[model samples]
Target chain A: MSHQSKRIILKSFPQGHPKESDFEINTIEIKEDEVKDGQVLVKLLYVSVDPYLRYRMKQVDNKAFQGYKLNEPLTSICLARVISSKHGSLKEGDNVTSWNLTWQEFSIVKGEELNKLPSNDLPLSYYLHSLGMTGFTAYFGLLSVGEPKEGETVLVSAAAGAVGMLVGQIAKLKGCKALGIAGGKEKVEFVKSLGFDDCLDYKTVDNMDEAIKKFCPNGIDVYFDNVGSETLDAVLLNINDGARLPLCGSISNYNDTKEAQGPRRTFNLISKNAKMEGFLVSKYGKDFGKAQQEITEWLKQGKIKEQIDERNGMEKIVPSFIDLFHGRNTGKVVVKIADE
Target chain B: MSHQSKRIILKSFPQGHPKESDFEINTIEIKEDEVKDGQVLVKLLYVSVDPYLRYRMKQVDNKAFQGYKLNEPLTSICLARVISSKHGSLKEGDNVTSWNLTWQEFSIVKGEELNKLPSNDLPLSYYLHSLGMTGFTAYFGLLSVGEPKEGETVLVSAAAGAVGMLVGQIAKLKGCKALGIAGGKEKVEFVKSLGFDDCLDYKTVDNMDEAIKKFCPNGIDVYFDNVGSETLDAVLLNINDGARLPLCGSISNYNDTKEAQGPRRTFNLISKNAKMEGFLVSKYGKDFGKAQQEITEWLKQGKIKEQIDERNGMEKIVPSFIDLFHGRNTGKVVVKIADE
Candidate 1:
């Protein structure tokens, strides 16, 4: 028997912000009997849409992260259930999570590469976000790189987003004064509800540096920088002596067609004896198990919280993903393709 | 009896590059009998002219370093001979080093604050440069912050200057490949003579990034930045993953009338997972004794070389100080005020 599956494919590379035209929906027929011996056919239930996907849409040959190829199905972390199994480990009806997932409703993945999710009371989508790559990113970026201490002031940019929210909450748990910088008032309110000490609406501020100075009187000791353009510059001006800046992402400049120009602030770092370091979550691959265990425990203890902005149906994936770049999503953007 | 002391004073702060008119030579009569109980009158032999003094010439108040007071003598590290003693320790004919010394033939310094140099075969001016703050700056900035590993490529800017020369030699001693970026062909020859693997004349190079790419094929692992301007921007593009940049000085912007503008390269730091940290030599005050001992041992073994640009007479102090900004001096700039 042959099954028809719908998938989204990259139609063209984007020069700046990605548009719906850059992606196209295609229906392909796959024969169930053609599944390889070591492969299992998975029925994808949820697909994660993240800001990093924007960087992948640009046609650049980055060794660290390769952009998606044209005419190919885009891949991301996905939650799936085994519909057919040919491998020894995976069987029909087994729920699993894998990073090697296509945008298609059905995928054939190697059984050995699939992570079997534990049957828990928490929702399965949590595995795609809070207990997944986003959580690991927040854990290593804040704890290892930023190294926030008790009584220190920690500032997080893009506070309403997935990694930023986790960073703020984790900093608060570590006894640091956590402040969030979000785009809108609703995001400010949302982060404040997530137990951030305070939230600044960057969209409303006349001058970001002055606003940061007013919020963090002692100056920012540890800055978890996600949006790395003007917001990063503002934080640089008000940083205390010996400040640590962990460069996690630069969503602000992802769409920049030309190089960005700003006040050269390296002098500030020299004057204050501060440190700015860039990092990626993959650097901590060896210790992901430990980080996952701790974050899962924190989730269970109510010390951490997870928020999701979910849209129904695979057809809404393109718009939902585009909404991330516009800063319309309050938390993790997920597209629910099917019910588990 | 009264002694007429010819001292250089800041007539006014300069808007950009300092001029001779901005400094005035004041001959003040000091009554020898007026020396305080805890003070010792000393004849200044070698007064150090450093690049940091230019930053002090600015009127803006910096908590890390203070500007020189107007109508007062400019102070710097000086090699002196005690002529008269008012307290217990210092005595006539005792050679000492003190940071409290002024740009004058004679200075009155507190006896207890003077560092009594041990009798050695090394030149007395060596106490002002190599075995002094410059040596300590290179030691801590390179080994402590940079932490260059064996076989790594270490690039030093302002390679012919005091701190930079020592940094290159030390990096070589640590089994790292040392590359130097200097201004002219003469400085390139000078640093290359100090066992540097290669030297780039930044003035002659039309494309610094291409030059760096050619020299450091594997990319720079550790960059000891001194001249921070366009050169820094070029290095930012070719930094390897996990590169360490120890920001020691930014002599390029010391005379800027306005804030510097450059391509915002923090995004590059993010993609490479690199770290850039700024530091002051004074922060390692407690560990100076240890660093001084190690540097002195290296100096004695002929493993490290010291170059001095000695100008004759105390009257030449102002011009010698000004020459540092012009990149005229090849090594430590010093004024020979008197001889023992």
Candidate 2:
């Protein structure tokens, strides 16, 4: 069988911040007979629009996030359904998620790279949020690395966003008092609705330290950081002894053309005997299987809830991604490419 | 042996930075017969002059280091010989060291607080620098926290000073290539003579980054940091992946009257996947015995060397401490108080 698939390709390397001109929509034809061994041809359903993808577009010599080459397909998380399989475990109807999947209508993924999702149990988009990379990050970053203890006050920045929301919820579930900082009153209320003990609107809070002190009467013990400029700076002054900081991302400084005034907390850490660790979810490859299983169980048990801000059409991938920077979406932002 | 002993007392607290005017060192008559059971009367020889004493001079609400109150004698590391022991283990003329010893000519110490030094083996001052708090700090900071691996590059700031010098030598013994940062050419040569792979004088180097790169070509694995400001900022950029930084002291920013720029390394930790642990030797009280025994063994084998800059007279304590901020001393500055 011969088929044609539409995909987004990297047209050019980003100069500083990404522009729509950097990506091009292209159509490519493929044959079933040409399918490689240990590969599954998948029809893309939902693609993850993440902040790290923007860094990948820049031509920087970073070993952590290797920049995408010009004219190559842009890579992101994709929840896809296998249409054809040459792999041992996956069948034609198997639904899977791949970190390397592109912003395309269809993709030929390596069998090992694709994780088979339970078809009927959860929302297909849930795999893109709580039970996927976003949730796994929240779990590992909060539980394992952050080591939030019961009765501890946990502060999460970008709380209404994908990873931050789940991190605060997970911390709350573990008996920790959780507080979230978001851009608007709506996001703050949204985070509060998700069971955070307190929420702060960073846009309105002129003196973040004063606001944080009011909410966190004791002091912050665990800080799950995503937004890293002023929020981090304020959090630094409020951290208690033996505070754990899991620096998952710095979305605030990601697109900054010049060096943003980074939060200087090194001096605070000394006085408080605090430990701050920055890590990527990819580093925990050994525990991913266990993390996914636990997260999936949590989702089924209603221990955690997820909300997806759905954007329609594959053509909206760039716009959805750009919206992420502007804090326009709530929960996990996913672009639904097709109807189930 | 019915005798009266002299003691020093703090008549008042310092307003900004501590001065001689803040202290009224009065000679108190101590009747040795009044010493209670489980207590030992000691004749102090050497009083440890540490930079942390300055931090304690400030009136703060911090539980860890509450500043010295008005009319209270400052307590610090002291080398003393027990003149009377009522609790049995200690005897008259037995040399010892105490974490609880007062900064005076004579101290009434609890028997539990004193550790009897092996007088037949090592110098009593060896117990001060190599077997006492300084040694324990250097040992624990370098080996336990830093985790120095063989063939890895270990960089230490404030190298010719007390703890830094010892840390460099220990890193060398662990088969690591050691680089040190000192304030002058003389101190730089001094650290180099102690078997460090390289030593950089921050005073001479135009660019800290260039100097660090020149010394640590392979990048730093373990950084025994004493000076934590611009020097630390430079080390942060050059640290290798999974690097360990034992935050022993931040002497550079200790006395900063102005809001000096804090060390910029949080992003480097994210990029390099490095970990900087701020620790105090007091926190590891459980393992102090094991560390002391190992350090004592190392000292007997001539594997580690110590340098002490002894200042004669008790009145010199305030001036000697002031000199520490100006980078005046070459080694561990000890105040030798004479008994008349």
Candidate 3:
């Protein structure tokens, strides 16, 4: 039961923007015997790339996130199948996903660390977007943190990305006017097609404030911010009283080597009685089932559509991840390593 | 009865720091006949000068806080005595306080807008600090927004100021390790005398980050931020996981004629799973009596001491308010117009 597995590792800390050269792949041989008591051998199915990975690559002293070490295989929330098990719960051929899954074809993981996926006919890749951490992020950040109310205008930045698109549609489903701020015309069109009332192409807009005001004439009631910089500052100036900002990531600043040190329009928070809450999807693990049930219902009823930007081959992992920083793809970016 | 009231009016919007020339005292004659059926004539006892007033001097479109108009009387939360009443609830010689009160010797105010004092025989000026809005601000912001838990480290900026000192003391009372960041050495000493575990002198410190780390060895759990520019940025770097920031004001950036467009270290919020909630004291008006009762007990037991920087004359109102921006006051700055 010997097998060879190729995995991507952090080669070096990127200088400004992450490049393909920053990651290296190494092949390792392991036997099923390595799956000791209370462990399972998992065969990787799909690997997910996210903006938050950039944060892990840095040498941060924060206890919540220890920086990923150099020359080590990077881990993310990945979809995999249990190849062999000596654990109490899992059996071979069970579809499972865990945040601890490595960027490899197969690896030995703690039995308790992996969560078995439900037997659903939906595309297995949908777990990476619609029913996985991405969807849960959209659900909790929008519903729990953002709290978009009926008839209120909810604005989302990076409105075409994995989490953003779902957030916009969900706000609309809740009877709010959904507004989006995306980078390009194509993304804007895509976002608008997803039931967003309006979308602003920040790339073409000369004045961000004016562009935001044009679409959000009534001012933003909830801003689901994925990009944080001047975009957030501009939105701050246009928020309604008691506006809620549910921030997940600042993808715009993730690529920068130095801190942006930009002026935040936080003064608006006091004057407008607004609030900004930063959250991570992992914190909502206990309530994931509740969110997943509703999301599954929405998908089955054709009430929500999640776009997948799939990249084939394990060899393209480095390039596929780098593509995200350059805004080369929309929707949930997942690299296919093996067939489901 | 006819009387002349001396009132402070906005002379001009100052460029950076406000000056004596920015305000002009005007004398106006009013007759008791001007008091409507539901209005009371209140004689000013004490007028408060706070940092938030600086924000009101500028032009902001926020409906929660409209900017002060040119050539008009400036108003704030003031303590007064009803000289005459044409209202159903109030009578002559009734001691009261109102946020709607003008900065003058006497003014006609709607009775519904006034909160009559209970005649607690405590110094009437204490209503402007310890037993009033400032105490409630510290109470709600720290307990509700900051949510400092027992044994957690709570840090407060502008710790010598009215709200900050109380926030630190209240955090201590909640069984937390209270830390403070003040401007000067004397102010830091004053804050320490009020029972804070440690205090940082931002003015004399060479490195703010190092200074904060030195005081907050474990990491900051709750940060009551009054000053918002670089101090906030530095504090962000030292926060613990799940930190709560209750922001009542950003006095550091208030005087800046131009927006401080400095980069906020908000990325820390995402990494530490932190939250920043901007609040106004007025929103907690309904629950103020509970806060006032608790604060009154603390004051009676001498568990907490509120320092007052008293300015004696109405003619010195402009200078007294200006002293705040220059960091000349160590506690709540109250301008006394008349004695009870």
Candidate 4:
């Protein structure tokens, strides 16, 4: 017996921003004999669409992470079910998550690369967001790098996004004043509902520096920067003495053909005796288990909330991925390919 | 007999770069009987003219250090000889250093504010450069903040200036490869003569990014940034993974009426997992004695060199101060107001 599977493949590298033309949907026939002794055939239930994928679309040397090879099937974190297995660990009907899975309806992966999920009361799609990489990114970036103190003010950019939403909640849990900057009124309202003390819509704010001053009366102490552009410049001007800025992401410049322009902030940093550090979640890989445990407890206690924007079918994958660059979706964007 | 002392006063705050007119020289007659209890009349020998003084010439709130009050006598670090004293500490003809002395030929200061220098074989001017604030700043900013390790490449900007010169030497002593960036051909030659592994004249270099790549084959591990402009941008592009940049000064932007313009570098910091921190030398006040001891030994062992750009008289002070902005002088700029 044989099955036909659809996969998203890169057609061309983007010059500025990625477009539908940059990708191609290809169908391939996979025979049952393709599942080797150590491999499992997985039917992807949910595929994660993240902002970091935009970085992978550019062809550049010395990238922080390796860029996807040309003409190869795109890969991402995915929630899948084992349709059949020839491996010792995985078996048919097992729900698992794999970080190295192809963005396709069906994938043949090594059993050792997949982690079988224990049955939980939460929605299976939650594993693609709040209980997954997005949650872990916010965990280590805010707690370890930002190091928000009990009474300090923590400001997060892209507040309506997956990582930013969790960062604000975690900051609130730690007894810090959580403030957020998002793109629109709806995002502002969304983040405010997540217990942020204040949420400013950057799209409507006339002066970011003045707005920040009014909201953060004591000045920003811990700035978890996600949108690195004018917001970052304004924060630099209003940072408290000895402030800490953790550079987690720069979604604003991911599509830039040239380097982003702004006020040089080294002088501001010197005057305030501040520190700015850039980091990736992979740097905290050794401690992911600890973060996952704490986040799970918070979710069960109803102290944390997860927002997911899910799309139906593998054909919607490119649209879902493209939507991320336009800030079209709030929270985590996940594409559901099949039933678990 | 009364002495007529000429002092420099801030005529007005500078809009951009300071000019000679922004400072006014006033001659004030000090009566011989003005020396009161717990006070001393001191003749200024050497007055330090530093780049940080340019920042003091601006009127702005939240200044890292207090700006000079308009229409008031300018004060700075000075070497002085106590002419007379009414305090318990017998100080007739005693050589001392005072950080709070007015920029003039004579200053009447509280006796307690003076630190009597012990008899030493080093030149009197050495106390103003290699053995004073400059040395301590380089020590703490490089060793403590930068933390350059053995065999790593360390780069310093404004390499012919006081702090930059010592930072490179200290890095070399720590077994790191020391590279320097200076302005003119002569300045580049000066730093190269001081044992820096390589030196680049930023003024003459056509492409700074290419120059950095050429000089730093292994990429920069530690960057002591003194001039923040194109040099900073170039270094950001070539920094090694986990690089550390200690922002000691931003002399290039001090004269600008508007904020300095450059490429936003937070993204680069993230990709490289780098850290940049700003600091004031005053933050390390408690550890000055230990640094002074080590620097004095290094100087005596001929492992450290100090360059002095001396101006002849108190009248030449304003010109000397203005010269720093144009990079007309190298190392420590000091105005010799009187014989030591």
Best by DockQ: 1
TM-score of each: 0.97, 0.90, 0.95, 0.95
> lDDT tens digits, residues A1-340, model 3?
8789998889998877888888888899979987899999999999898888877888765556657898898998899999999998999999999976889888998999998999977999999998998999999999998988899999999999999999999999999999888889899999988999988889998888787777788999999989888788888888898899988888888878777755378877777778888887777889999999999999999999879999987887778888888889889999998998
lDDT of each: 0.87, 0.82, 0.87, 0.87
Q: Give me candidate 4's TM-score against the actual structure.
A: 0.95
**CAPRI band for model 1:** medium
Q: Show where candidate 3 strays beyond 4 Å.
A: A32-35, B32-37
Q: What is the DockQ of candidate 1?
A: 0.68
The fnat scores of all predictions, in order, read 0.71, 0.32, 0.63, 0.78
Q: Candidates ranked by TM-score, best first? A: 1, 4, 3, 2
lDDT of 1 by residue, A59-169 (tens): 776666667999999988888999999999889999998875899988777899898887777888888778888888888999999999999999999999989999999
* Chain B superposition TM-score per model: 0.97, 0.93, 0.97, 0.96
- Angstrom error at residue A71, model 1: 2.0
lDDT of 2 at B279: 75
Ten-residue region with minimum lDDT total, candidate 4 chain A: A259-268
Q: How well is candidate 2 docked (DockQ)?
A: 0.44
| Tens-place lDDT digits, model 1, residues B1-340 | 6778888888999888889999998788777787899898888889898888888888877766777888888888888998888978878999999876788877777898898888878888888787899888899999999999999999999999988998999999999999999988889999999999999888888887788788778899999999887788888888999999999998888889998774367677877889889998888899988887887889899999999889988779888888888899988888898877
User: Which segments of model 2 are wrong by more than 4 Å?
Assistant: A1-5, A9-40, A85-91, A108-112, B1-41, B70-73, B82-96, B107-118
Q: lDDT by residue for model 2 over B1-340, one digit each (tens)?
A: 5544555567655554566677766776667887899999988888888887777776666556656776777777788888888968999988888876777777677888888877556666766787778888898888888899899998898899989999999998889888888998889888888888888888988998888877788888988889887788888888888888888888877766655566655677776777777777777778888987888887778887768888887778778887887889887998877541
> Per-residue lDDT tens digits of candidate 2, residues A80-180?
89899999999998888888887778777789899898766678998888888888899888988899889999999999999999998898889999998
**What are the runs in model 4 whose C-alpha is more than 4 Å off?**
A86-88, A116-119, B86-90
